[model samples]
Target chain A: MNYPIIVDVTLREGIADPEGATIERALPALGFNGISHVRAGKSFRMNIDAEDESSALAIAAALAQRLLSNPVIENATARSAAKG
Target chain B: MTRIGVVVFPGSNCEYDALGAVSALGAEAEFVWHSATHLDGFDGVILPGGFAHGDYLRPGALARFSPVMEAVAEFARAGGAVLGICNGFQVLTEAGLLPGALQKNRGLTFLCQPTTLTVESTASVLTRDAFRGQELVIPINHFSGSYTCDDETWASLVAHDQIVLRYKENPNGSRDDIAGVSNVEGNVVGLMPHPERAMSTLLGSADGRVLLESFVGAPVGAR
Candidate 1:
C-alpha cells in the first residue's frame, strides 16, 4: 500500500512570523487588497509503500520523525486516503 | 584550540546539535547565553537555527539586537568564522550580517526533505574541500528558506564566489538557486538547510561529515 503525508508549518494564530509581516506589507502595493495575515511555510509529499494500510501509516510516521518534518515548528502526519 | 560558541536564545534548540558537531572535531563548543554581550575569546561562532525570541519581529530581528550580537558583529568585523544554519541563517540576514531575506516557500508550505545541495564555493571554509559542484543530500526543515535579494548585490555575490551552497534542484524558489552564502571576506557563512542533521548515514547521508569537516579541515564525526 502507498500512503501520503502532509506537513503544515504555519505559525499558530498567536505566533509571530516576520517573513509573513514583510510579505503583508508588500501585498497592498502589489494590488492584493483586503487580504490579511499572510503566513509562509513549506510542504513535502512522500509516497511510502508498505504491505498494508497500517504498515504504510507506520512508515509515514517514521519518515516524519526521521526526515520529513521538524517536530518543533511543524505539525505533520500521514493520511490513509490519497488526498493527504 | 578552536573555541567555538553557539548562541542560545529562547527558541534556539539546535545549539546542542551544533555543539556536538563542533566538538566532534576536537573543538570545544561553548553555549553562550543570548543575553551575554561579550564574545572576546572565541575563534568561531555559530548561530544555529531556531525560533529566536519566539520568532518575534522576524526570525532574527530581535536576536540581531541581542547584546551578544554586538559581539558577533565585532567578531565578524575582525574576520572571524561564523556559520548560521536554518533559523540562524534567518537571524544573520535579519541582522544584516548577510544580505537578503528568507521568504516563504514557493509552494506556500513547509518542506522537510532530504534535499540535495550543490557546492557553490570552494573559497569558503564551509565548502572548500568539496569538489566544485559536488552534490550532497541534507535535510531542509523550514518554511522561510527561500532567499530573495536585489540585483546589485546578486551580481557582486556571483562575481566574488560568495554563493556557497545551491540547491541541486530548485526547491524553495530561492533566487539564483542559492542555498547558502558567505560575506565578502568569506568568513561568515549562512545556509538554509540543516547540515547538522545529515552528519551520519544513520540519519540519511554521511556526506554531511565532509561539509561540516570543511569548517576545521579535519573530521571528528560530530553532528
Candidate 2:
C-alpha cells in the first residue's frame, strides 16, 4: 500500500527562535495587532510504500527522528496526510 | 612529518584556507573528498568551514552522512585528532562526535568579525600549545554560530572540562559565551571561529598560529 505522510519539524520549546521572534516583532508594526508567538519551521511530504498505514507512519516517524530533525534542537512529527 | 587531512564537502569553501594555514605551519596538508571512505596514514583531520550541502535542512545535517564521515568517525575513535571549524563544527555536532548544537545567532544576523577568545582548556589537541586564560583573536563568519545544549548536557560538558574556548564578549549569544568545545577524550574539537583565517598578523592577527601549531605539532593519534 502507498501511504502519504507529512512531517513537520519545529524548534523545540525553550530553544531560542530568532526568526520567529523577528517575525513577531514585525507584526505589531504592520498594523496586525495581538498577533504573538510566531515560530518558523519546515515541513516535508512524501509517500511511503508499506503494508499498512501504521507501518508507513512508523517509518516516517523514524525517518523524521533520524534525518528530518536534530533531536538536540528540533522536534519532528509525522502523520498520515489528509486525502484531498 | 605530520600529515593532516582536510575533508572537503561539495560546498566547502575553506579547504584551501585550511590547507594553506596548516602548510604554513609546517604540516603536510591534503584535501580529502567527502566520498572517500577511508583516511589512511593521516595523523589528524580538519573539517573546514562552508555551506555543506548548501546548508540544506541545516548547516551540517546532510553532510553528516557523507561517506568520509564514517572514516572520520573511525579515526576519531582510535584517538586521532579531529578539528571542526565553523560549518564543520556544525557537522561534528550533528555526527555526534561532539556535544551541543549551533543555532541561528541571537539577533538573526550574519556575523563576520574578529572575536577575542579566551583559552578555557588546554587539554585538547587544538589548544595544547596555548596557556590557560590566554586570549586569541580569530575571525568568525556565520549565520548560525550560537551554541546551545540542554541543561543535562551542559552539566556533563562542564564536569568533563570539555569546554575549550570562550568568547570574551558573547558575540552570538552562545550559551555561557562558549566558542569551542572538545570531546571527553580531548581528541575531537569543534569551534565556530576561523583560526585558519588568522594565520598572519598582516591579515589581522597571528594568534591563530598558537592553535594551529598545537594541532600540527602533535604526534599521530595523539589523544
Candidate 3:
C-alpha cells in the first residue's frame, strides 16, 4: 500500500517567533487588518510504501523526530494526506 | 605541547584559522577529517566554524551525522575538552553535546560585526582561566546565531552555572543574552562568537587568548 504523508514542524508554544512577528507587523501597512497571530513552520510532503496507513505514519513519525525537527524546540506531527 | 585536533567538515572554512590559533598558542594542532572513526591521542578537539553540509535543513542539522561526530562525542564523554565556535556551536547543539539551538537572527539578517561578550562562568574547560564578569571583544559572523531553549532547560542551566558567556549588547537577541554555554560536566563548550578571529591585537583584539589558552592549558589529568 502507498500512503501520502505530510510532516508539519512548528516551534513549541512560548518560543519567540521573530520572523512571524516581523511578517505580522508588516501586514497592517499593506492594508491587511485584524491579523492577531502569525506563526511560521516547515512542512514535508512525501509518499511512502507501507503495509498500512499506520505503518507509514510510524515511519514518518520517526523521521520527523530524528531528522525533520529538533525536539528540544520544535514539535512535529505526521499525518496522512490521502482522503478516506 | 598540548595536541589539539580540529575537526573539519566538508564545508568548514575556519579549520585553518583554528589551526593557526592553536599553533600560535604553542600547542600542536592538526586537522581531523569528518570521516575518521576515532579521535586517539588528541588532548582536545575543536569544531570550527562554517556552513557544514551547506547549512542544509537548518545549520548543523546534517553535519551531526558525520562519522567523526561519533568520535568527537565519545572524546567529550571521556572528559576530553571540546570547543565549538559559530557554526561549530550550532553543530554541538544539534549533536546534543550542548543545550539549546541557534535560530535566525531576530531581524532575519546575516550579522557581521565585532561583538562584546561577558564571561559569565569560569568553570567550563573553555573559560577555566577567564575571570567572571570580564568583557571581551570578539567577532560574530553568521545568519543563524540566536540561542534559544525551553524554560526548564534555562532554569537548570542557571542553577548549574552552565551559561559560560553572554553578549553584553545582545546582538542577535539570544535568549537571556546567552552567547555561550557548557555541558553539565563543563567539558564541552559552545559559543556563537569567533574567538579564533580575535586572537591578535593587530586583528583589533587579543581577548581570545584567555579562552583559547584556557583550552590548551586545561589540567592534563582531565582528558
Candidate 4:
C-alpha cells in the first residue's frame, strides 16, 4: 500500500533562528499579543509505497535524516498524514 | 601546470570569475557542467559562488544531488583538492563533505562587502602554504552565510585542525568566528568568502592570492 508521509525540519533548540526572530518581532506590533515564542520550520508531504504505514514511516524517517534535514543544526521528524 | 575544473551549476554566477582567477595564476581552468559524471584530468575542483538551483528548499539542498557531486566526492576521496566558495560551501555541507550548515545571517540581513579573515590552520590542502594567523581581505556576498554546527562537531573540527579560516571580525556571526573549514584529510575546503573576487589590488585586496596560490601549489595525492 502507498502511505502518505509528512516530514518536518526545524532548527535545533539553542541554534540561532533569525528568520523566526524577525517574524516574532513583527507579531507584537501587529496586535497579535501573548505569543511568547515563534519558531519557523519546513514541512514536506509525500506518498511512499510500502507494505504499511509503519514501513512508510520508516522510509520517511530515513529520508528525513539523510535529506530533509541537516543534523548539524536541524532536527527532523516523520509521521503518517492523518487523512492519508 | 595544475588543471582546475570549476563546476558550474545552472544558477552559478561566479564560475567565470573563478575560472579567470585560477587561469590568471597560470593554471588551466575549465568549466565542468553539473550534469557531467566524470572529472578526469582535473587536479583541482572548485565549486564557485552563486545561487545554485535557485537556492530552493534551502541553499545547496537541490544541487547536492547533481550528477557532478558524485564525481566530486570521488575526486575528493582520491585526494584531489576541492574548494567550495560561498554557495559552494553550502553544497559541500549538504553533501556531507563538510561538517556545518550555513544559516541565515544573525540579523536577517543579506550581507555584501569585503571582510578580513585569519588563516587559523595550514593543515588543509588548500591552506598548507599559508602562514597561521595571517590575515586576508576577501569579499563575501550572501544572505545565508552564518555557519552553525553542534558542539560535538565543533570540538571534533577543532581537534582535527579542520577549522581553517576564521573571520577576524565575525561578520556573519559564525560559530567561533569560523569562516572556513576542511575535511580531516585536508583534501576538501569550504569557505564563505569569495577569493575569486579578491585577486587584484585594484579590487581593494590581493590577499586572496595567498590562499589560491596555496591550492594551486599543493601536492596532489597527498593522502
Model 2's lDDT to the true fold? 0.95
**What does candidate 4's lDDT look like per residue over B1-223, in tens digits?**
8999999998999999999998898899999999999999998999999999999988999899999999999999898999999999999999999998999998988899999999999988778878998999998899999989989899999999999999989888899999999999998999999998999998799988878888887766754
Query: Residue B121 lDDT in model 4?
Result: 91
Error of 2 at A23 (Å): 0.9
Tell me the native contact fraction for each prediction. Answer: 0.00, 0.79, 0.74, 0.84
Better of 3 and 4 by DockQ: 3
Residue pairs with backbone overlap in model 4: none
Scoring only chain A, what TM-score does candidate 2 earn?
A: 0.93
Q: Let me know the DockQ for model 3.
A: 0.78
Give candidate 3 regions above 4 Å deviation: B220-223
- Compute the lDDT of residue B46 as modeled in candidate 2: 98
Determine which window of 10 residues in candidate 3 chain A has minimal summed lDDT. A11-20
TM-score of 4: 0.95
lDDT of 2 by residue, A6-76 (tens): 99999999999999999999997889999888999999999999999999999999999999999999999
Model 4: residues with Cα > 4 Å off, grouped in runs: none
The candidate maximizing TM-score is: 2
| Docking model 4 quality class | medium
Per-residue accuracy of model 4 over A1-84 as CA lDDT, tens digit each? 988889999989999998888899999799999886688999999999999899999999998888788887888999878673
lDDT head-to-head 3 vs 4, winner: 3
Distance from true location, Cα of A40 in model 1, Å: 11
